[model samples]
Target: MDNQFPIPGPSVPGEAAPLPTPEEATPPPPSYQAPVSVKPPVVKPSPIKIILPLLAGILVVGLLVYGITKFIGSRLPSESVTTGQTITLTYYGLWEPSSVMKPVIDEFETQNPGIKISYQLQSPQDYQDRIKTALEGQNSPDVIRLHSTWLPLFAKNLFPAPANSVSATEVSTNFYPIVSKMLISGTQVYGVPITMDGLALFMNNSMFQQKSLLPPKTWEDVLSAAKTLKEVDPLTGKLTRAGIALGNTGNVDHWPDIVSLMLLQAGVKLTDIKGAEASATLSYYTDFVTKHRVWDDTLPPSTVAFANEKVAMIIAPLWRAPEIKSINPSLSWQTVAVPQLPDSDIVNWTSFWFEAVGKNSKHPQEAWKFVSFLASAKAQQILFDAATSDREFPQPPANKAVASLAQNNPVVSPFVTSFETAHTFYTASNTRDAKTALNSRLIKYLEDAVNAVSQNQDVVKALVTLNNGFAQVLSQYGLVAAPAAATTP
Candidate 1:
């Protein structure tokens, strides 16, 4: 049976009556329920997508840093190193650049692409000191300019030419006989001469002609001229002019020149294959200035006398020729071989300038090659020409053949002739110390003797004292190997 109210359709067992009105209907509070179990969709990434972009960014940053660092480094100057392939050389000298030397150096460089050269110039007065300091400091130049007199000082430390560069026999044959001997000591040849110079009598020709005097040919003539020129003003009693400017205190390295020339003239061997001679030779030097007064204080210092024309003659080197011409172009002058004592044969002093190698040189082969080039006849001839024309020093070439090229020039003829008879000054094996002693003690003795003569001291006693002092110095250096044979002058 159907009830009229629709029997509360769909009524639950535990029913609560609900008003059907829309406004009155209230639903049970909403209840939360657990969600249904369903697996989430899986996603996979591609290797390229993950790694390529990251790697590209990293690479770009790395490249940028590298470029910046390289750019900064590029701004710095390059310092060269002579590794296994390259070579470097160092040279010292009185280098006056000329078109001649420039081409020679350029040619050498062009020939040896693997080599580079460094050059240094030193003044004549400081040459020895600079060399000694360099050697002791272990900072020596690969090649150095050496005066022949200073060779003995650097002998032991020198690097001889290698067998590959030149044989000893060839060296002797190639160079002048005297120069070859000079380069040798014991078993080793230590250096090669690049240039030569010698002492000569430089006379003011105009002055001689004015006085109606012939150029002095003998020591007596020189003495006579000195006396004639040694005039005192009647009122002032002061000297006006000195005939010959024999070397004095202010001249650079003048005493040795004076002593050596005199000794040679006197037939005194200052040194020999045996060693230094102590007595006869040095005593003669002492007597010449102190006792004879041939070279007296009456003459002014070299700089004053020569510059002022107060001296009519001077014993100077061929190198001085250019300077003289420059100083007084109007003053006519001529050079002659230095005069000899009446009883003695003429002998002049020889001096050489050379190139030497340093022990610590990075490129010894390159250094030797450069030196060889400099010593070559072609290079020497160029140097000779340049020295004559540009430098005014007219350095005589080391090569006799090259020197002969200058023979036609009248100004150079006398110097060339003088070179043939020149003798090297004696220098002890310990040359630096020996030269100092010579300039100081030996030179002072001569000076003192001159002063004594000026003060009217007995000439004989002064000479004896000088001789004794020289003997003591020789003994100190072991140079006086034996008792000197006594001789009466």
Candidate 2:
């Protein structure tokens, strides 16, 4: 009744709220009023609550990614580990796949499974240059096969063998004396000699027999044979057959061989064994070509002349034996030490090749192991057999014992004999510049003397010119020793 809906109660301020105490304010419950039909408040989910589950899922995913990253990192090989385990080696191709090296390499692999090797074969001509480039680029192979002639050039680039890996004195004692000396630089042995090749006189036996002459034992005998071989055509005044082909350009790149042979024969120390002097023992060489007129440029190249039977003699290595036999099986040829100089014992040029370890190699130890195995007596024996049989081109074994094993093989005997008396050229600094100067200028001077004689230039004049040039070269390299106030020849 009284406009019946309850009026809003805010009309009274705080004083009206004290009107009733809790006991007096209790209102009697409406008698059995129908239950209120109140609906529950419509509640909506919070955006924050929904986002929390998604955040937890994202966190779990991130942790899984982190764990995976860590697992992969742990499994990768460490750089240091890789560095300690691998080695790479490089060598020039000595023989094709069918030769002695194949089995040796396979055997080495079988014996050492933990160590891995990578082999690279290069042409002999390009090997040194390639090695030099690799060394300069800091990518050098751990091991290399070096020519004995080239050892001096590359000695500086090699790493000394690890101490105690081999017994230095014992190893040195195991090789031929000449072979041993070639591998020594001061007290350090920079290389291990694997094989050697020495100069030998290769003769056409049939030609010698036909000429009613025996094989030459002395330079004089050779001269006589050469003289008899030359004849003049009555009508043309032209020479028919050359007595000898002995020039640098011909099949004879054997200038060092000829020079060393003559020098040894003359009792000249190729190098001042004491390192006191550096001089070319050119007199004998000059005399041989000029005095005898044995080498005339008029003849065909040595290879052609020998192949065609136009010339009867060639100074070649044991390696050439097979090729000579192959060219003419009926040629009836034999090998002998280089003809001795007058009043001198027989001597020849001995050249030995070495296996060296590169300075920048990652696997120097492994590389050295391979080299050592190759130089072992067993390997040397295999090499000797292969060479003697002509299955592979022969190189003299560095091991004297191995060399002696070939004594019974006729084709190898002369080479072995020559190795006994052979000597090598002394390399002063073992530098490219030094080698180039020696090979280009010094060698050329000798070649020029040969050329002059072949062209009929005055021998004395040529010798004097060569001497002067030699002096200039020595001075250029600062190799000239102190001049004695009074020097004796």
Candidate 3:
């Protein structure tokens, strides 16, 4: 049995052991076999296979998260970010103080949780120069308050309103007609005005009552009233009381506006400013001194004259109401719409400020959002109320809806009524512009022409010079997009 059950040899280090003989390898008998425990051999997986699956899962999860984040962020405000930082917009405002704009700013920030407004009231001195410099600079205000006449001067630097924020259609529909003309370019709107103001006739109630005259409805009516109400000292041949403030830029306040209104009413295209209508309009304006003998340079400014009861009537914006009141609180006065052309549709003038977004602003979208809010009907009402509480009265709202509500307000009604048919030109006065500004430069030519006419110069020659001057100024300012018009002198 021992010889038959041969033992196996030791295995070589590098080689497998030889197979055992049948006798040596014989299995134990089934009945007498002792229990044997068996364990399977342990196997290690390939590192590349494990790592590839894990990397693939991680990449899929990362892509899913990134896609979700992008989709969610696209719907939020353009100024908003996932980091949850509030955007601050720098606003350069004129006239309205920080205290006046604070409520509106706060309301806007409340509505748009992602934005806050930093308001600064800019001084009127050199405002045009400063704003132009700011717009050209890298660090520019996000929002700016600009005059409607300055549109041509600043349109290149202004950011057009995004259709999603404020569309041209919305601007035309919601605001006054002049708004569309001033703010809308093609399908884009560049700005929105909070107030609507133009020329209105202010009459001393005592003077009108004594003469039994109603508010002038036509130019004829105005001329007649001027003649009837004027009081001249026969002994000194000096004007003790003036009829109207219509002639001579030296003493007439807002002479440019009055002149522009007359020109527009006479169907003179200010851009061209030629033809018989232009001559007649200028003559009509100057005639109040030279021919009509109603107003002259002998008196104080038109506003002061009206306040002192030295002038029976004056054409001025409603903002002057406070000044006139401050000058003479006990004086009885009434406001009426500016006189219209006889047998013609109503045509009035407008000069007011609007809110614009800077083209170079880092937060243009946010800026436009705040401006759009300020232009809304709700915001207009709020602003009008705020102004009313803050001061004696506010200018008529540019929002047609809000203006309509003030139809019964005596202080605002005349301007509100005029706004419906109002138009604006670049010749607006009191803009507090630089000497080299478009308005100031253009107004110089206007002043020269008016002075010439007042001094009895040939109307046709004066107007020819005026037309050439207008061409030069409009072309220089890039206000006229057309080819330089040929001016005949």
lDDT for each of the candidates?
Answer: 0.59, 0.59, 0.81
Q: In model 3, which runs have C-alpha deviations exceeding 4 angstroms?
A: 1-83, 481-489
How do the residues 1-489 of candidate 2 rate in per-residue lDDT, one tens digit apiece? 111111212221110001111121123576857678989999887799888999999999999999998888798877733535533455544333335565666667778765655556665554556667775557677766666555434655677666655446856678766655556544556677767777777777776777898878776677678777655568985556656665434445365456545544554343221110112234334433455555555666565567667677777666666666667666666777677745444456765557777776766777778777777888788766765564534666777777777767666788877766666653211112333545456666656765665566775676666656655654443344423355689
Model 3: weakest 10-residue lDDT segment is 12-21
lDDT of 1: 0.59
> Which tens-of-lDDT digit does each residue in 311-333 have in candidate 1?
77787776667667777767777
Residue by residue across 313-363, what tens digits does model 3's lDDT show?
999998899999999999999889888765565678889899999888998
After TM-score superposition, the amount by which residue 248's alpha carbon in candidate 1 deviates from its true location, in angstroms, is 5.6
The root-mean-square deviation over C-alpha atoms between each candidate and the true structure, in angstroms, is: 38.2, 34.6, 30.2
Show where candidate 2 strays beyond 4 Å: 1-88, 92-98, 230-234, 247-253, 269-295, 387-393, 426-437, 452-489
User: Residue 411's C-alpha lDDT in candidate 1?
Assistant: 62
Model 2 scores what on Cα lDDT? 0.59
Ranking by TM-score: 3, 2, 1
Please list all clashing residue pairs in model 2, or write none if there are none: 196-396
